[model samples]
Target: MGRLKVRLILAFLSLILLPIGVTGSLLQLQSSELEEKERSYRDSMNELESTIKRELTQTSVSDLELNALVNQYAAEINIKDAEGETVFTSYKDPEAAPHNEAIVDSSTLFHVQAEDGRILFVELSSQLPFTDTILRSILISVGSGLIALILLIIGWTWYISRTILSPLKEIYAATEEVKEGNLDYPIQYRRKDEIGKFIRGFNTMRTHLKQSQEKEEQFKEDRKQLIANISHDLRTPLSSIKGYVEGLQDGVAQTDEMQEKYFRVIRQKTDQLDHLIEDLFQFSKLDLRQLPLDQQFVDSRVFFQSLLDDAVEDGKSKNVCIDVPRQIPSVTLSLDPVRITQVMNNLTENAVRYGADSIVISTRIDHDESNFTISVKDNGEGMEKEELTKIFSRFYRAEKSRSRESGGTGLGLAIVKSIIEQHGGSLWADSELNYGSTITFTLPFLKKELV
Candidate 1:
């Protein structure tokens, strides 16, 4: 049996057996007392009978003397002659009165031959110590108490079943549902007891499990898409390179200019392939948390100056003007310089690839002085607001055709977001369709050493 069932059974037994044990003890005590009183009454009656017998033997006992003896003993006396006629009784009218059977059965009797040659029979009454009336009252009291006890046990059993056992059964059924992979099932108990808390906790756990399963399924779908994108991207460049090599072997490019153009196209395709592979490698490291950050405190102004110089140099080829704030914040920033440089490079390259003519880099410190914010705004054909949220997701390209033409692997912003977050920072973008876009990020400020 279950522990609770066993406990309830033991409790019921205690309720029943305890009262019975006590009642038995009380009844035994009352019985002993009753026996003692009966024995004493019998002894007194025997003494009275013996005295009367002796007195009759010594001298002829007068009726008045017998009456006096009966009065002294507080008993009833009956005296009969030898022929059983004309007996003297303590009752005033012996023929009109009948003796009680219980009193007669408990009475003492003796015979004595009188001096007149007649046998005298005398009987003395004995008072019973325990009566039928008292016995009946005791039985009624014990019976009522037992009935009340039974009612109490019944109510207790019902309470246990409703509050404890019922909920436990529901929990068991819920577990069975969970074992069958049904996470949507929930317990419907509403009380605020421990059992209710447990039920609520179970429901919460099921909800989390459901969410996790959904995320896992989504991740699987994203992985499939990633594989498809990688295959398509890899095949395009390899096919171009293979076509160019075959053309050279077949002498399809007869002139020097045509062969030079074919070789240049092949090198460009190879470069695209190299860039795609490098992005894949970087994204894989970031996703797996294998990319380590060499975080250090660096002066913000010096870092931005170097970053802007590199961006300006790279933007010159695309005719993109790289603009920066004349005054950079003089705070010390905590970041990985190499990773932050990669972030800037990716952002500026995205701007140049997306028809940006001018790229502006701005910096500001938060009012609380806890962190620094930087924004890279560009005059490019911006994206819709809906695309902003998904730009940081791997393999998510807002403009697939434009991305292919620009040789974009779609992991640039994703990598940048990862690097920023790993440095205890956040990144977001604000863009308006047909307008310009601004990509903003934050980095924590290095704490000042106490003097």
Candidate 2:
């Protein structure tokens, strides 16, 4: 910034000095030429005076004739003899003359036999007025130089302010716009200077920040929608539980079997509410504070085997089949065992509620050793493509009221999504209507990938 100002100042000074320097050089040349002219004219006058002397001595001209000849010959000087008298002058009538005094020339004293015996008088008059004219010319040269210098500097200052400062003003205004939360403006510049670099950097930052802001806003909107859907789902089930329990308590459900069924429905509602509360707490921790996962190295193969065993024990009385791929890796992976178990249960439960009588638990360690991917593909009535679009939204239930009837809080996929993202992995759902839905999640390995 300071450098640009310095350059501008330098340009201004140069503009001011350029004309003055040229004017000074030309004035010096003119003065030298004036001196040469004076010397040439002075030399010609001396030669002419010598010829006049020779003619007067050789031809023996009369005084009147000589005076008339001298008068005719004189350019601006008067010629006279001894006693300091005007013998010949351009003006004969002394009273009606242009001058306030008479001419005084005493060069003829050289011809007289004086005591000193030498010419004491000079022939030429003093050129004080002509010298004054030369001095005036010099003054004019210096004055013009100053005027031109000032005019040029002023003109340059104006041009620079308009062309340079005007654009800079725009840059400043755009900068203020960014400060006020608008990072959508374009920076216009072509100069290969530091300001151009600044504009480019600013534009880069604006683009990045704009993207981040958009993501944040989208996430907020999704969260809001999720909360609304969850509340709606919970309200319907809660209302059903409330109505049935009240009926039983009021003896409206007179049969023992009817009372028992109403109590079971209340219990299911309580479990659903508890699960939703827990999901909400965990989601908050993962999304807002980025809490560290309580992780440990556990053999993933054995872990899935244990999950399969628990599923068998729980579903032995029900019509269900749980499957774990035998080719699952035996590698020790790091993760929060409890949270991962919760995720597995959530995915399995989602399948159990919406899947067919058969559910598959699959795991594979691909050539990409950077992460472990697990998929729980269900054979139940699958969802449409539109459901896949919002499968990870919190509290978004595809089956509507049926989701609450199936003990679903609609946050299983949403929580899985958050945890995967927190672990620097990814989760996604692929499904075909009435075919099946595959809920897949990845857990990143601690080390970077190897070729």
Candidate 3:
């Protein structure tokens, strides 16, 4: 911007000064030429005066001889006798002759006495070098220069206003719109100049602001849905617990075996409620970015082996089989062990809950060696494409009924995604309806010595 301002100022100064300088130079040259011509005219008049005086001293010439000698040097000549009567006059019209001494003084005048004692008065007037025509031409030239300068100034002003001031006005208007909660307004300028760059920056800022506003609105809506889901989930387990307690209060469990079954049912529902509450708490922490990570550079083989072992044991209880490859990569990884364990647990449990009979855990490193990926594949009743897109959204469930039989708080995958992202990784899913699903996540690889 500073450079642009300096350039405009310089250009404007050039526009104003160029014509003025040229015109001044021309006028100076014209004045010099006029002075030279006036000097030459004065020298010619002096020479004519000397010649006429020398000739009159030589001989008493006739009027015709005198007329011929002085005709070339003078415009009007009048010869007067000693009595002051005009003898020889060159004036075709007598009124055109000089009547007073003041008029005679304006022209070159000389008096020489002929041998016969008559005075020859010679008045020499030359045409002026600086004429009305030359003056008119000078006026026209200066006027044209002034007009062109004004037009140049006007053109420059219009260009500056269109390129600079116009965009500034648009930016001001966009700011006003943003202030009034309208983030969609964008400036339309395409010049690749300083002003163009500024406008582009402003437009980018507006786009980010609009996106941020949209995310905030979405977050609010997700929070509302979370509350409703929690209410519905809690009520189911709570109602069962309340009903069973009432059954015991009413002495409905008459036999020892029946009473034992009632106690087991109450304990199971209580556990479900406890699990739901714990999931809600962990999800809240992850959502709020308050979950602390105890990061360490740990061996990938040992980590996955331990994770698979736990998942295998847990899956057995749920009547699902967990499998792993024979060889797990021994690469080093930077991660929070506890968070990653939770992520694996969520994926495996989600597979089991969705009725997968077999779940396979696999790991591979990318060709670049910068990151490694882990995929939890399951032979479950996979989700539709539309559901897959939103699987990680909080409180979203592929099961529209949100049945308690699924035994989840609808935050498992969402929590998994958050934890993975916090670990400087990403999580996504691929699935086909009635086929199987693969939940893949990547973690950045770390050098063993960079711990």
Candidate 4:
């Protein structure tokens, strides 16, 4: 902008100055020529006057001869005396009356002659040479101005493109790269203007982003190390306890009472170990994509009902219900029934112990046919809104005090979520304090829409 402003000012001034310069130069030259012509004319006029006076002194000369002498002097002086009429006369050819008298422009000389030799007509035209030169000067001024304007435009455009536009383009490209997550870019454009300040701000932002990424990476490494250490320590003692409990139950240690006691301890230790390992494994899987999924044609109603029955028939003494729809659509999918069954079992058991004794397993087939949803509802004791949010997180138990005593592996719900996600489904929980809780999961349709 600064350079453009300068060019604009120069252009306007040139519109006036250029013509004046050329015209003045030509005028100076013409004025010098006129002065020399005037000087020569004056010298010739004085010498002619002296010769005419000398001719007049010869009284014996005839009238024709006197006229002839005067004419000879007039031809030398390049001047003539007339009645001031619009006619030209030359002294060299007076009898012939050739038209042409004095020299034109500044080269012309005139001297008055009278009967008393005091006053006579004396006139000369000085307009022709000066006027011609002025016209030529005006033409040259216009041509020269046009040439200079063309050259100025070309030079200014080149300068603006190289020093301004190109740098702005580079700044734009660097800003795009920063937007795309490359936080290290040279954003310094030394413009000494607002653009320079903008570049400095961008560089500062990049530095902040770089520092943030470095800290996040370091935190991730520390977390990984801590999880590995805790997992190792847990697995080791669990294996020992399991082995000893099996030995006693098999009669290697003799008494039934001892066996029952050992088995109880074994159960608690195994639950703890399993919870830790599952939490780590599920978290690791969740961080990656393209996890393996094994699915098959399945009637979810029957599939979920069996899990309820199995859990009820098992050692746990809880009333579990299969409250599915009368008719549930069957879907063919790339799924693993075994893994899915494990997920259902985990949710049912969680409901039975943590939320309620009586559980209802049901299915919802919506009108859109976009997906099939399965829910397990419990009425024992519901949880808070905050608890439901963290319920699917590993090792997160709403009733911390009660949960630690139940011998539950806190990773059950988390494991269920991971399995469902791998099958292209999602899971969520809805609960109200003391009103009961319901956990629902949706599996997308095999053909992109489920019945």
On lDDT, the candidate that comes out on top is: 1
**TM-score for all models, in order of appearance:** 0.64, 0.59, 0.76, 0.49
Q: Candidate 1 at 174: error in angstroms? A: 3.1
RMSD to truth, every model? 8.6, 7.9, 5.9, 13.2
**Candidate 3: tens digits of C-alpha lDDT, residues 385-410:** 88878999877788846446545877
lDDT of 2: 0.68
Per-candidate Cα lDDT values, in order, are 0.81, 0.68, 0.78, 0.62
For candidate 1, write residues 66-110 as lDDT tens digits.
765665555778888878864677743343333442333466777
Question: Model 2: per-residue lDDT, tens digit, 48-151?
Answer: 56655554455432332433433433433354455666544433333332343333332322232223332222243322124555666788788878777887
Clashing pairs in 1: none
TM-score of 4: 0.49
Pairs that clash in candidate 2 = 355-380, 356-380
lDDT of 4 by residue, 193-302 (tens): 55566667777877888888876875586366546545554656567696886787677767778777777877767876676566556555644543356668765556
Q: Which stretches of candidate 3 lie over 4 Å from their true place?
A: 25-129, 190-205, 367-369, 448-451
Q: How good is model 1 by TM-score?
A: 0.64
Whichever of 2 and 4 has more TM-score, that candidate is 2
| Local error of candidate 1 at residue 284 (angstroms) | 2.3
lDDT ranking, high to low = 1, 3, 2, 4
